[model samples]
Target: MTEFLPPWPLLTAFVLASLALAITPGPAVVYIVTRTLAQGRQAGLASIGAVALGNLGNAIGASLGLAVLFSVSALAFSVVKYAGAAYLIWLGIRALRGGAAAADGGTVEAAPRSLRQVVRDGFVVALLNPKTAIFFAAFLPQFMNPAGSALTQSLALGVAFVLIAATTDACYVMAAAAVMPALRRAGRARALGRYLTGAAFIGLGVFTAASGSRAAK
Candidate 1:
């Protein structure tokens, strides 16, 4: 309803905006970077897959007017926000303690988790973010084509945003992985990675805790 027109005409601008947003640093980006740095590209991709799906769920929910619940219900928002913040901090602490090592200068190859569990962890990380719903609510409307079905337009834009994010995030992950061999060859990076990733997660949690309702991206 906000100057929305035919999608074809608006598509280019939407893509540009989405790219800009995707490139801008956020919790999702930080998470991907941390995962890649802590493990490898594959782990980063796994986390991204879950995050994307979780975001897709939020986008669909936003298209369905779920933000209204957050808008009108402070308790709901606070509960979700706090929960997500706590979970991130917990994960950070766990990473700090474990550091994903086997105490013999080797990675944790023995830790075998099903893809389903990985997906679930990622989904929960995303689902706990109330701000993402708020973000979709506020951000998508600007590019929406009111001439078309508003819900459909929102959904389409949301998917596009997710795709853009994944592409950009993949680039970053790959770059981080590309450097792994160098870091490994140098040795003494295990503790560094543990502190860096743990701090990032904790920082993200703090940022989430401080976020306000209706704050734009």
Candidate 2:
């Protein structure tokens, strides 16, 4: 196992790069933060877990040559990208509708999502984005020792990246949750928060659809 690892210099670079990548706010961070703001810490943490698993799946898929398929086939990439965008848009629309209904019914808050549903949503959000798999495929190879077992090295690097990402994601969740109380102090504010959350989701979806593959890098 140790023999498959990269040299110290390459490993240090990989860790630094992974930290930078994980800290940069992307679709995954936005989704997790939105869940945290709307639901609570628990939901945010659940989303983190689910997204981590999804990212791991993407990493494994990359190791298995799925990224190559996306690279060669525009249609395949488009299919997955559109599916993810559509799902995000759907979530946004649902959030907006829920907010409107709450206002009409004289309620301060929208109904809470179940943890299972949140997990499923987070998983799908992470998994359907082809960029993650492409990123893993593109990024993981840089530090791998050519003489080492490619499969083992890729898997190890992928897991490290995922763990780093999960940690950063948790930090975002904590920060969002910290401010959540202030945002929800008033009924009107709570209602407005829902609208903002919905708009954020919609905007994220649009951005995802419009973004080129270069954005992942």
Candidate 3:
């Protein structure tokens, strides 16, 4: 049997790549930013916690070769991708509606959401995201050592990804904190921000839905 462990050089490369990818602006980043700006730093942190947990699931799945299954099984991938897209669209619609309501003199609370709820929501949002699943499935393979343990390599790569993502998301929280006061002081501005965020979610959903079909590797 061939070993599936990654070499030190490959591990180094994977770590660097994972860190870079995590820092890049993406949907998760947007979600964290919007949540932080709308609620507060605490809410953003909560969402991050949720996202980390979700990513951990993906890591485990990938380690177990479920990501490989996703890559190979069109039906499974479609199921997950469509579900994620639909969820994003639903979230967008809700946000847009909420924005409209707020514009009409609805009271807006500045209070942050409970940590548990934020973590749960974040975990689902990140876990169900097909992009993340596919990414790990494809990306982790490049550095895989034929002589090492596949599970260990996958877990290691996943840990690096989660750590990098957490650090970057924390920065997003801080950035949102800088603008929280402004958002709270101007109801109309906040409403507009909410609408824009909703629009972004909608666009992401459409993009996900339209993403090309991929064969399992």
Q: How well is each residue in 118-216 modelled by candidate 1, as lDDT tens digits?
A: 566667888788788888998888877766778778888888888898898888889889988787676667667777877888888888888787543
Best model per TM-score: 2
TM-score of 2: 0.94
What is the overall TM-score of model 1 with all chains considered together?
0.87
Candidate 1, position 72, lDDT: 87
Please, what's the RMSD in Å of model 3? 3.6
- TM-score result, candidate 3: 0.84
What C-alpha lDDT do the candidate models reach, one value each? 0.78, 0.87, 0.75
State the lDDT of candidate 3 residue by residue for 1-217, as single tens digits.
2354477788788878877777788778887887787667888888888888888788778778777778788889888888878877877787787777666777643222477766776777777765676677778879888667777777777777788889988997998899788777886676676777678778877877887643111
Q: Write the per-residue lDDT of candidate 2 for residues 51-137, one digit (tens) a residue.
A: 999899999999989988988899999999889889888888888888988868855344246999899988988898888899999
TM-score, ranked from best to worst? 2, 1, 3
- Which is superior by lDDT, 2 or 3? 2
Candidate 3's displacement at residue 129, Å, is 1.9
Model 1 ranges off by over 4 Å: 1-5, 99-117, 214-217
**lDDT score, residue 172, model 1?**
82
Ranking by lDDT: 2, 1, 3
Off by over 4 Å in 2: 106-112
In candidate 3 the C-alpha lDDT for residue 121 amounts to 61
